[model samples]
Target: MYEIIFNLHSFLAYIVLAILGIALINAILGLTGKKDFTLEKDFRISLFALILSHLQLLVGLVLYFVSARGFSAIQEFGMGGLTSAARLLAVEHPFINILALVFITIGWSKHKNLMEASRKFKTIAIFYGIGLLLILSRLPWSQWF
Candidate 1:
């Protein structure tokens, strides 16, 4: 179960990052060109990113409960026993990833309430950009790649 969830989490991370990058670039182009926010493309891209990110969050949550590097590490080590890598997997990665999702959610919600294309683009750019940065910062890059 742990291996399955972990693999799912890892696989989904790539999808989430790709969607986010596409959304971010689209948002930037919309903002810079002062173009209309079309429902067909812009909205769909952002929505896809949002959905993929949420799925990742759910997978990570499950992995946390079942993986030895997750809750079990905390149980066995009592916090101090967690090596830096263990702590990254059990705490930092999950927590920051959730935070990134929150920011993405906020961006999606805020964009819906806005009527102006520029405003919507700005909201997405700021929120999604921040979320992307946070996720990148916490990724177990060394372990993952």
Candidate 2:
């Protein structure tokens, strides 16, 4: 079960990052070009990104609970006793990813409330962009690759 969930979470991370990056780029282009936020394209891309990210979050939460490198490490070693790699897995990565999701969710909500196309694009650009950056910052590059 742990291995299956771990693999799923790892695989889904790629999809989540790619879609989120595309959504961020699209938002930036829309904002810069002052393009109309079309339902067929802009809305769909943003919605897709949002959905995938939430799905990733759920998978990650399950992985965290079940994986030995996650909460179990913290329990076994205590917070201070953990090595840097252990700390990253047991603490930083999960916390930052959750924060990233919050930013993405806020962006989605704010974009909906705004009537202006530019404002909507800007909201998504800022929030999702930050979220993406946060996720990138804490990624365990050594383990991920």
Candidate 3:
């Protein structure tokens, strides 16, 4: 069960990263080009990114409970005994990821209220960009490669 959930969480991370990257690029282009925020493309891209990220959050939560490097490490080590690697997986990764999701969610909600294309693009660009950066900062890059 642990292995399965871990694998699923790892696999879903790719999807979440890819979608967020594409969404960020799209938002940048929309903002720079001053393009209209069309429902067909912009909306779909943002919505897809949002949904995939939420799914990843759910999977990550499950993995946190079941993975050895997650809750168990913290429970056993109390906090200080956790090696850098263990700390990354057990605490930093999850915490930063949750924060990224918060930024993404705020971006999505804010864009909906904006009537101007520039404002919508700006909201998504700023919020999603920050979220993407946060996720990148804490990813287990060594393990991933």
Candidate with the larger lDDT of 1 and 3: 3
The candidate that achieves the highest lDDT relative to the unseen native structure: 2
lDDT, residue 106, candidate 1: 96
Kindly list the per-residue Cα lDDT of model 2 for residues 63-112, writing each as its tens digit.
99888899999899899999999999889999999999999999999999
Better of 1 and 3 by TM-score: 3
Per-residue C-alpha lDDT of model 3 across residues 1-145, encoded as one tens digit per residue: 8888889988998989899999999999999998999999999999999999999999999999888889999999889999999999999999999999999999999999999998998899899999999999999999889
Q: Write down the TM-score for model 1.
A: 0.97
Where is model 1 more than 4 Å wrong at Cα?
A: none
Q: Tell me the number of clashing residue pairs for each predicted model.
A: 0, 0, 0
